[model samples]
Target: MPKLVRDRTLPALCPFCRAEILRPGEVEGGEWYDFAAGSCTCGAIFAHDPTARNGGAVFLQALLMVSGGDMDRAMELAEGVDYDVGYVQKYNVELHRLEPNSFGTLYFVRLRALGGD
Candidate 1:
């Protein structure tokens, strides 16, 4: 495991609500074998992609979290209508900063109300 370092100047934040985010932790009973994840106060779930590749898996993890681990429910929802997606690229999980030229990314997913309200 790599040592985590924080950037004192800028704090990592949630893309949806701009709230300072907590460090990613092991997800309990998650779908994948091993993954780091966290959530924001505004109901957005995020998955850390250290390589910035595997975005599809990261996104699916987040969507599944928001959908209560229901893959069918997660797949049936339409983007922008049933939910919204946001991401912070160039993220550094160890440093907790959006470093320039980095390849890490944090994929976020927030579900919308079903009534079209």
Candidate 2:
């Protein structure tokens, strides 16, 4: 007789509402886990699915390409995605200087564009 096995992975939590996330499947063209859940208590549907690569790097690259490397326009795009222009500006300054870290790249990018890289 063959033994049965089960997959055990901790459920992801929603960032906006702090609710338990229900994994549907892999995000389209993304390796990170994708989750869906009921509307948040705050009346907002929160969806968080990060890409397989560095988000910040991707975001910076896109912004540079779209805005022609204009920091001010990049800030505007960031604001359109519900991201704080100040925060994007702060990080972009470092990114423009060729800083040596890819951390928070995705977050910065998503917050800026609200779209995948």
Candidate 3:
């Protein structure tokens, strides 16, 4: 049996489980904003395409075509992008400049919009 996992902080609902959460939380600053992501408490899992949103696509495109694997510079450049959802960002362990390292692959995730929560 799959363990029940629940996380209401996700930008969207979990497809597998009908977990209900009030909503995600939001934080804001000058030219920057983020959401308080919820931890998955149940075993529910879902797959998402980072480039599904136009903002995500633009950022990913920049990271791949423009930055050419330059995650850091791409991140810096992506700051200006505004997503209807929330925003796009590169996330992962090991924060370093764009250099050859064991960091594997950089991850791009979409945050919830300010009022989405």
- Global CA lDDT of candidate 1, please? 0.82
Candidate 2 — what's its lDDT?
0.33
For each candidate in turn, the TM-score is 0.83, 0.26, 0.21
Query: How far in Å is the alpha carbon of 105 misplaced in model 2?
Result: 11
Q: Which 10 consecutive positions of candidate 1 have the poorest summed lDDT?
A: 6-15
Model 2 scores worst on lDDT over the 10 consecutive residues at: 84-93
Report, for every candidate in turn, its global Cα lDDT versus the true structure.
0.82, 0.33, 0.30
What order do you get sorting by lDDT, best first? 1, 2, 3
* lDDT tens digits by residue: candidate 3, 4-102: 865322223322233432222232221222222221233311112222344444335423323334457546654325221222132212332122322
Top-lDDT structure, candidate number: 1
Tens digit of per-residue lDDT, candidate 2, span 46-68: 22223334444444543433354
As for model 3, its CA RMSD to the true structure in angstroms is 15.9
Q: What are the runs in model 1 whose C-alpha is more than 4 Å off?
A: 1-9, 114-117
Whose TM-score is higher: candidate 1's or candidate 2's? Answer: 1
